[model samples]
Target: MTSYNASLRARLMPIGLLLIAMSCIQGGASLATSLFPAVGPATATSLRLIMAALILWAIFRPWRWRVARRDWRDLLLYGIAMGSMNFLLYQAINHIPLGIAVALEFTGPLGVALWSSKSRFDLLWIAIAIAGLAVLLGLDHGNSDHTINLTGVLCALGAGGCWAAYILFGQRAGEVNGMQSAVWGITIAAVVIAPIGLVNAAPAITESHVLLIALCVALLSTALPYTLEMVALPRLPTQTFGTLMSLEPAFGALSGLLFLGQALSLLQWLAIMAVVTASIGTTVTGRSAEPIEAPYPD
Candidate 1:
């Protein structure tokens, strides 16, 4: 009985970690939205990256790991991609609800998954995803509130593109030490966003309460979730991991509702469910597929 329990725990541990990571990530996003009025979205994003980079550097000591010249290019691209993705996401949520923003942003990985696969079944999933997107975008005429901002949708799409780039670059970066690569990559991101954030929202960012909240966001959104994912990735089956991660839209919606008091219409909820289902279907059918690479602090 003892041995059986041990085995069961081992199997369940990764699932638990992934679930926790998803919750923390979405929760952090919702929390960051609350900070936007004070620090602005760009500054909040900068603070999160800066704090996360500091924490990861202290914990991982990535400087101790030597990188090859070729690896530097990969890391640089990875950082840029990650920074752009987060910045764009922050900009997006400023204009749209968290759930809608996340659903649209997920198109990046969904596109990548479909592109990488040659299977005919992938087309079916893609079609379903498109239908969902149409509904989400109010193209289906189901939305009474046609107040969705075009710029916000574009920003989310841009973030999705950045996310795709992050995934591509991360595959190469992962060839190095995982924790080290993450630390250095985030540091580079912090550097990239610092000037804009500091220039626009310096006073707010320097406030004691803002700094404290930023620290909490860094831990919840970046350090903790990333660490849990790193631990869980190797243990979980690729399909299982992909399916679980696809639930991020639902989690995002939940976080938005719980933390920000954001509500979604019935059609909007169904649209989110459709996209998630398509993602899961794509993942399950894709050949020997790795899970969608969650772009930093997802």
Candidate 2:
């Protein structure tokens, strides 16, 4: 009985880690919204990526690791995808609520999961997801303040597309040590986002408070979650990991409500639930095409 209990604990620990990682990431995103006024979203994104890269590189010393020449293509793609995804997501949350933006962005991965499926049941899930999105975007909730922003929705969708690319390229790049690959990938992302951020909000980026908040965002959104996910992924089955990750939108909603005071209406809540169900169904049905290395949301 003692040996069995120990084995069960070991198995459960990774799931707990993944849940903690998702919560940290969603909470971090809510916190980041508070920084947008002080340092524009672009600048905040740049700072977060730069700080995350610095921390990861310091810990992993990716520079000390040798990379195969063949891996460079995938690494570059992964970095570009990561940078674009973060930048776009920040832009999205600036205009939309965190939970809604996350739900929209999740469609990218959902699309990937459905892309390879020949099952009729997958179509049902797809239709259900579309209905959820329609309700999310089109339903008259009787509050004029609840109107959806088309541009923000587009930005979230763009981020989702980039996320799909990240998953694909990450799979190839992740053949290297997880920490090392993350360091290099995040560093490259920082480099890519730097020029745009500087051009848009150079002076704001220099503020002491902005720097502090950016560092916190980096630790909460990237470093901690990435570390936890890396630890969890190898231990959990892909289906279990994906199902757990499906809770991210709900987590985002809760964090937004708690930290940002962004509340969802009943219809919106139903929409979120619909999307969540689709995601969970996809995972449970084994149609999810997620990478073995879990994707990180910033």
Candidate 3:
């Protein structure tokens, strides 16, 4: 009985780690919003990528690692997707609530989950995801309000699209060296994003407080959570990991409410849940789903 209990505990611990990782990521995103006004989303994104790269370099010492010439292509695409995903999502949360943005972004993964499905069962999940998106876009029942920011919605969807690309390419890149691929991806993301962001927000980028907040965002959203996820990855099945990650939108919503005071309506909450359900449904049944290793919505 004791041994059985120990086994149960071991199984559950990874889930706990994943939960904490998601929560930390959402909390980090909420915190990042506070900096959006001061430095703009572009600069904030640059800081996140740059700082995360530095942190990963320190820990992984990617300089010592050599990449296969064949793997470079996948790694390049993964980095582009990762950087673009972060930039677009930050643009998204700039105009809309974090929960809504996260829900919208989840469609990328949902679509990935359904990519090769010949299964009729997947249709129901697709319907759920579409319905959620429709409702959030205020397209259902032909009712959209001034409250909705179309640009934010579009950016979030784009971010989701990038996220799908990230997962597909990330799996390929991760095959060779595991999380060391992450260090490389992050370094590339920083290189790609820093110039664009710095060009846009030159004046505000140098403030001490901005640097501090960016550091915090880097730690909460990237460094700490990435470490936790790496630890949890081996312990859980891909299906279980995928299902648990579906909870991210809910955590994002709660973080917005708690830290950013972005209260969502009942209808919005339900829409987010619908997206989460679709994500969970598809990934639980999808043929090639896996845990996401990229940094989140920040």
Against the reference, the lDDT scores of all candidates come to 0.87, 0.84, 0.86
True lDDT of residue 71, candidate 2: 90
Per-residue CA lDDT of model 1 for 1-298, tens digit only, reads: 9999999999999999999999999999988987899989999999999999999888888878899998999999989888999999999999999999999999988888888876779879988999999988989894467667988899998998988888888878878877777788899999998777878675676788999999999999999998898899889877798889789888998889889988998888999999999988888888734444543446
Model 1 steric clash pairs: none
Q: After best superposition, candidate 2 residue 57: deviation in angstroms?
A: 0.2
Could you arrange the candidates by lDDT from highest to lowest? 1, 3, 2
Backbone collisions counted per model: 0, 0, 0
- Residue pairs clashing, model 2: none
Query: TM-scores of all models?
Result: 0.95, 0.94, 0.94
Query: In model 1, which regions exceed 4 Å deviation?
Result: 142-144, 288-296
Please provide, for model 2 over 108-182, each residue's C-alpha lDDT reduced to its tens digit, 9 standing for 90 to 100: 778877775555689778877888888778664556677899889999999999988887788888887666777
lDDT of 3 by residue, 1-298 (tens): 9999999999999999999999999999998998888988889999999999999889989778789899999999989988999999999999999999999998887787788555567989988888888888887655545257989999999999999999889889888787888888888889998998888685767989889999999999999898898889889887788888889889989999999999987888999999999888876666653445443434
By lDDT, the best candidate is: 1
| Candidate 2 positional error at 259, Å | 0.5
- How large an RMSD does model 1 have? 1.6
